[model samples]
Target: MSYRIRPAEQGDNEAILTLLQGTPQQGAVTLNFERQPDYFRGARVACEQPDVWVAEARDAPGKVGAVYNVGWRHVWVNGEVRPIRYAHDLRIAPECRNGMILHRLFRHLRKQLAEGEWMQTTVLQDNQASLATVASGRAGLPTYYPAGTIETSMLYTRQRMPRLPADIAIRQSGSADLPDIAALLKAQGQHKQFFPYWDVNRVHGDEYCYGLNASSFLLLRIGGELKGVLGFWDQKPIKQTRVLGYTRGMGMMRHLYNTHSVLRGGMRLPAPGGVLSYLSLHSVIVSNDDPELLRLLLDYAVAFFHGRYDALICGFFQQDRLAKVAERYRRRLLLSEHFLVSYDGDPRGTLDMNRPWYVEVARL
Candidate 1:
């Protein structure tokens, strides 16, 4: 089949949505990550600077066979705030999964990529097909260097608050608190690689913070000094995770799981075709990278959002000790292998891996 790979145009939105809907991610609980109403809205929220592309079949005029996005943002890399790319949301029509189309798309991407540029992408550990292809060393394809594993958890919100010092306060922030939040994030984020380096403008104006503002953040303060911050972004209006179906074992246990969930005040298993109701935990920053501070912030967030959201979704690299905080809560875990990709070979060797990774799960 003759194919053309080009920058995505506004008119291709519907076809792209069709491709996403038809390609439900395969797992015990199959899910369709959907962008309804407007796909670009969700894409913009993923990255302030986004370059989206689509693969079109010459014979099938308006049909989109594949789609990919390169999301660029400023993040703390090696103790400096630098622009880095995150490659995600790659989807291909089931019938067009042959190696030719993928290779052609990669060839186009390779031609467009800047010299020595490297980007990060993640794939579920269970996705052997994609892992195999990335490791195939196919011509014109970028090299995928294994970085680390990221553990995303849907931590349940129905939990008791942790006891804290009497001087400490956790409350919803106001407009006047924006600058403090930004300062706190910047001051502490440098200790973690890939932590976002954003200011008040990005917080207020960027699509990445769509449907959110100062009031959306839960700020932790000790004796009038800012200590921590966590923001909740509700992306349901633009993007949704719809349950397509489940494996026979999961299907059989669905009812039992839901019953247990209700009894424990946890998130219930939604029926097939039902959308997941949750919030993406973002802008996480705790003073001095202290685990206790993170625990205070997360616990406060859990209490603040309880009964309002099904879960609070967050991720941490396997080596990050902060991940232990989420693990203590009732939750579901999803693990993905992170990789660094470059046309140049093995970029990981030159990079410093001392700092723990901190990819924003909300953007991924």
Candidate 2:
């Protein structure tokens, strides 16, 4: 049956939710709504937004089959703010898995993205169907490899912190440390196609950076020279009873980012006097190119978080040698084979998934 593609409406939320729930092969069925209502709400909000799109079979009215949640962002690349599009979520119901359905939907999506000047969507590594769909098209090409799946790794420890064979020490970052952080970030910017919204400067200036009653950043220093850094935030899970309070009037899109930001921040937002564990392994780097130094820095970061929090989660790219280094620390693989696509300048030069670098989607 022929399908009609149109923008989703508020009334279609139930159908969309049903489709999402019905597609079990996509996994994440046990996703905690209490902890992350924003994900579901954001899907509805995307449909309501003019930029979002939905596909429904013309012969089956009211049966929403697929969804493509897209958004725009300005990336600082090559010293300029470049407009890019993020394809956040794309789902197709099981009943609509016919190849023709996907073909038509993708064709429509490509046309929309091309006209809108969107660069690309960062596909999750495990979503093989989506990856194949994008790669099947002539217009589609592998762009960027963001990170490996979210996995449980060895708890952070002080001893694990990387210290150069010389005199490096792991210490709390200070306001004065922003310049060195900026310099490290600038070095990363040179090779990356798309720039993340939260950079070193923003992190240093944001509320999360100031650490109001909570630690947010850690720096590895050698003889007063900054060599590596990490960031974290305090976060806690919302009880089922508190779901209403958490969901109360939160805008869909904003809530989406909020939930993800909280999760990615790696620390749970603290509940009232409840001494919930507080910490997140935001980012890590070691200036020493030696693999041994990198391993030391990673071990130390994990040890730091493990000591501070009940759980330590990190996002490392598949190509990053750190992924292998992290494995030595009892890291349990959570999400593996995630894909990131970027639309930088020229598509050819902008997308390079084979490069060895971890893309940080949300900073903890």
Measured against the true structure, the TM-scores of the candidates, in listed sequence, are: 0.96, 0.58
Deviating ranges (above 4 Å) for candidate 1? none
- Model 1: lDDT to the true structure: 0.86
Residues 228-346, candidate 1, lDDT per residue (tens digit)? 98888888998999998999999999999888876675777789989987889888888877899888888877777887887899999989988898887889898999999999777
Question: Could you tell me the TM-score of candidate 2?
Answer: 0.58
Instruction: Give candidate 2 misplaced runs (Cα > 4 Å).
Output: 1-35, 40-51, 55-65, 73-81, 98-101, 115-166, 174-180, 192-215, 233-283, 288-294, 307-311, 334-346, 349-356, 361-364
lDDT of 2: 0.50
Tens digits of lDDT, candidate 2, 1-364: 6679998776676776666555433231222112122333443222222255788878888888887666555455545456555565567776678657666765676666553243444554566776666666345443444333433342333323344566867666766777786676456544444434345555433432332222356676768777666555443331111111122233234346436534443323233223334344554555633455556656565556654564455566555565666666543355544444533333444545544444443321
The TM-score between candidate 1 and the true structure equals: 0.96
